[model samples]
Target: MEFKFTAEEEKFRVELREFLTKELPDGWTGGGEEEGDDWDFELEMRKKLADKGWLTMAWPEEYGGSGASHMMQLVFAEEMAYQRAPGRDQFGTKMLAPTLMIHGTEEQKREYLPPIARGEVQWCQGYSEPESGSDLASLQTRAVEDGDDFVVNGTKIWTSNAHHADHVMVLTRTDPDAPKHRGISFLLADMKQPGVEVRPIINMANNHSFNMVVFDDVRVPKRNLVGELNRGWYVGATLLDFERSGVEYSAGTKRTLEELIQFCKDNSRNGRRLIDDPKISRKLADLTVKTEISRLISYQIAWMQSAGLVPNKESSMGKSFGTELQQAVARAGMEILGLYGQLEPDSKHSPLQGRIEQSYMMSVSATIAAGTSEIQRNIIATRGLGLPR
Candidate 1:
């Protein structure tokens, strides 16, 4: 396959870059730290992207989206990551909306997808439980049907952005009698409903991005059911594959690495420039090669998606490698900065706006969240390499 971008695609890329350079909000970079909950920053950023029709570039035009090619979507993701613009909270636009587009009834699509596309609503995922982190199928959160309403009762830990979410795409047990993997259901629950409580779960950075969401007999209408009852495991797994398929790690981490390289040039260590070290140059060269490989893997996934192929293994591999590579790059920055890396954003002389310090902490979470490095390896070995688990 031809790896180079088409003439038209290259032209579009230049135009998008120019637009982002001109339009991106000042003082905004993708990483570092945001001051508030996911909903607030996401809504504002979504408006900026939505106004440009960039949020729905991969979605169909009938749904108020651009119906752009998958390559265009990749371009958009890359540009946004490079510009350090706030990301579209993955639950609404990236994870749930894609599943709804594929499986939701017309009513469901009309009800949910529009607001998400227009940046009018925000959502979070309620999948993992306190006891069921990696072993997702063993989750015991139950949703018993009563007439037209389903009463949801369980606690979901690490529910990212749940406190400020307008809705939650929740995975619940609708058939306890069925096998572990076959008894689940995906339901859209209104976060504002009675009996739904969100308690903050602070992270290593003292930031409150995750939450413990307790659903105490929360009533959700039967119409909120996604696909068929007791078949949510498959649906949720498919959606996760799509969610993990994006190339954020390569694009996003590369941005930080570039910034760190500049930091090395601008800053000093041992009365000399950090970049003057031969070891630093060697590490950067290796990182540059790895970044190129990551870009290739990401482009392959985009090409597969463009060709209407299910990107299961490719996405898994991409997430697996990209995330680990991010951690490596962050560690490299820490090595370069030495004592300066310890100085966080609040410090007066912290390097690169103290981003290296923030990334050093955040990158650890990236490896754990969205499926751990160990889990990704499991997927790649079992599914991609056809190895026995």
Candidate 2:
């Protein structure tokens, strides 16, 4: 695979960097409280990206996208990550839209894709339940067919951004007796409906990005069902593939490493610079190597998509390695900063604006989210290596 970027791609990156430098709000460090407090700002920023056709640029023109190449999409994602931009919607723009393009009806695409591309709607995923965290197929959320609609009754836990979302793409069991995986169906439900409820789940970081979403006798039209009935397992699997494959983790790590390197160069310990310390320098070097590997994996996935290859185990490999690298880098930064790293961003003496501390807290969830590291290992062992389950 060609690893070098074309001149056009490099030019696009430069333009994107310039745009971010000029357009991003002053004093916006791309870090903030994760709740309704930043909704307005996020919406405003997202609209700007949408207007530029940067959001969903990799999608087809029929779906209101620019039909940009995969390399361009990678460049855009990297730039957004580096700049800490708040435009990309993981659910609507990244995961759901691509799945819809492949499995959804034409009407579904027409109704859903434009709003997402225009940044007029936001979506949350309703996959994991209280009982079905990693063993997702064992989900008990039922959607019984009644008249022209399906009556949904169950709860989804650890649902990210449900409180701020306009819609939710839910995984429900449409057939009870057919077996664990075959009985599922994917349904798109309106979050504003009467039967839908969202309660915040504050993590150890004190971040309120996650929520518990409950559906009580929620009536969803049969038309909202995605792909074939009792075949949501396949669609959900594909969504996970999209979720796992992305440049965000690697790009974000690269930015953090850059900041940390500068911090080490500027700061001193004992009588010399932190970067001059062999231990700190060696750790940073190791992290740089891992970060580069993560970037290569991300590029490989982009190349696979461009070549029309479905990434199964490769996505798992990337997600597993990338998340682990994020955690390691965050830990190393905190260790390098010592006492100052433990302080919050608001503290006057905090180093790197306490980003390392914040990342340390957030990193705990990286391995658990979008399928855990354990699950990813299982996929690699069984699917990639063809090992016996």
Candidate 3:
């Protein structure tokens, strides 16, 4: 289990890093919990990746993919996050691309994959409803069959990036009589159609990254259905597995922690550097250990993927460890900065352009978004430890 990259992989990482440096705009850093505005900055970054044949790098070559090794893809993610490149819009690339590759027909692949790869269109996930968050199986969004379309009527809350997305991959109750999971169908809907409305939800950071999307008898083409009828749960699970794959965030979190430490040493408050404090030092040490552990777990998941093994337990371990470690690092950052951490970026005297303040606020959401900390624990207990529910 030596996790060192091969010479070729090292070279690949450097090349991608250089490309990102040259292409990413001067002020464009990847959006995190605290990156102030949406501005579709990631769409432009994604297009750069697409132009370099880096977007959809893991997909098979026939469908606009380089078909690079899975480990290479993981390395790319690490480098991108390390550089603070715009956080990827997972709805299109991470979640839907894999689903379409697996469950979509040849026609669907030809039609959908290229635009997504090119960043010509954006997408959002429409999974959670007002009533369904962790208990997603209870979603009540319904889609009834019509002559050649499905008339959809439902509301999806916390639809990340829906305000900017060109389309959404939604889960709807296509068969109410069946068991909750079995009755659902995975479908795609055009966001610009007659009945779609997206309302922004302001987070604690006063940003509109998440939205509530309302569908008022929206008409979706029947061809948009993915996988078999009444089998959306399986399709959705595959996408979630993709979401939980690899622990790329560990390296980036470690890097950010290093930067925070440097900031503490350089900044003096009441004539004492924050790094001199015993509590801050101990917290950093703990976070360092946790971050390294997360990195190892992620590498294990990457290795399993290379061997064509399903990364059920390892994925859960990586995501759980990586996210928890990030939250810990963010907490430690706030402790080091003390009062200055409260200043917003717009203030004239804020430290690090208010980066730390934003990190603290956004970190609170990290444990809740994607999946909650509680849900991750449940997943690990049930799947990794083989515990009965």
Candidate 4:
């Protein structure tokens, strides 16, 4: 298979890099501790990306997209991750929009897709509950049909970015008796209403990205139901497939590795550069090889998607390997930095702006989010290898 990018794709990459360099603020190193306080700046940047038709470039033109190719989409994702841009809403643009395009009704599409493509609306996912994280089919969130709405009740835990969301894509049980996975439905619930409450769930990194959202008799219009009633499990599966298949994690890991290598080259220990240490050089080389492998896996998934194939087992494998590698890189960073790695991002003496420290904490959640490593392995074993459950 041809792994190299075409000339046009390379040109697209260069153009994106130039745009990012010109648009991003001076002294910006991609991440910061003040992300939550920069809401206005985030909105402005998102709007800029939207105006350029880069937010949903892979989507069809009727949906406010540029109808760009999958290779362009890969290029965009990699560049965004490398630069650590803060604009693209993962829920609205990445997970929800594609799912809606595939399964949403015409009315639903007209109402939602445009605003998302314009980067005017932000969405949060409501899937995992207190009891149903890994085994999501056991989610207790219930939505009973009213006159023209569905009254939703229950809670969703580990919801990312609910505090800034305009809407929530909630997975609820519409029929409790019709089997665990068969009775579910996906609903677009407005977050401004009184029935919905969001509480922050601070992680070990002390970040406020995660939230616990409670829905108390939340009224959702029946028109907002995505796909068919009691058939959302299929839709959710497709969305997960999209979520798991991406080049961003690998790209981010590669950037981190490059930064770490630079740090090693510049720093010294006992009058010798860290890069000169045989042990450090070997570790860095090992990580470099693994990062390249992860990149290839991501490209393979993208290629499969471009060919109109659903990469079920392949997506799971990519997610599992990429996340695990991320954690490994974080661990290696901590080891390489020694006591300095424990310093928080805001610490004056911390290296790489304490990015390694923050990553070490954030990496703990990567293995569990989207789908756990165990679950991905199960998919690989049963679906890919034809092994017994």
lDDT of each: 0.83, 0.91, 0.80, 0.90
Clashing pairs in 1: 30-84
Look at candidate 3 and tell me the lDDT of residue 34: 33
List candidate 3 segments past 4 Å from native. Answer: 25-41
Sequence-dependent TM-score of model 3: 0.93
What C-alpha lDDT does candidate 1 achieve relative to the native structure? 0.83
Per-candidate TM-score against the hidden true structure: 0.94, 0.97, 0.93, 0.97
* Stretches of candidate 4 exceeding 4 Å from the true structure: 33-37
Across 109-166, the per-residue lDDT of candidate 4 in tens digits comes to: 8899999988898899999999899999999999999999999999999998899999
Candidate 3 has its poorest 10 consecutive residues by lDDT at: 29-38
Candidate 1 off by > 4 Å: 25-41
Candidate number with greatest lDDT: 2
Q: Determine which window of 10 residues in candidate 1 has minimal summed lDDT.
A: 30-39
lDDT of 3 by residue, 1-389 (tens): 56588898899998987887787777554555432254666666777778887767777888788888878878887887677776355667777887787788888898888887776888888999999988898999999999999999999998877888889999999999999999999998999989999998998876778899999999999999999989998888877777787555697787778888788788776788877877777887788888888888877777786676667666666777787777777777777777877888788887767777877787786776667778888888998888999
- Give per-candidate clash totals: 1, 0, 2, 0
Model 2 has a clash total of 0
Per-residue CA lDDT of model 1 for 204-317, tens digit only, reads 876788899999999999999998999988889878878887877788878888888887788677798878888998899899889878988999988997787768878778
Candidate 2 off by > 4 Å? 33-37
Clashing pairs in 2: none
| Cα-based lDDT at residue 370, candidate 1 | 69
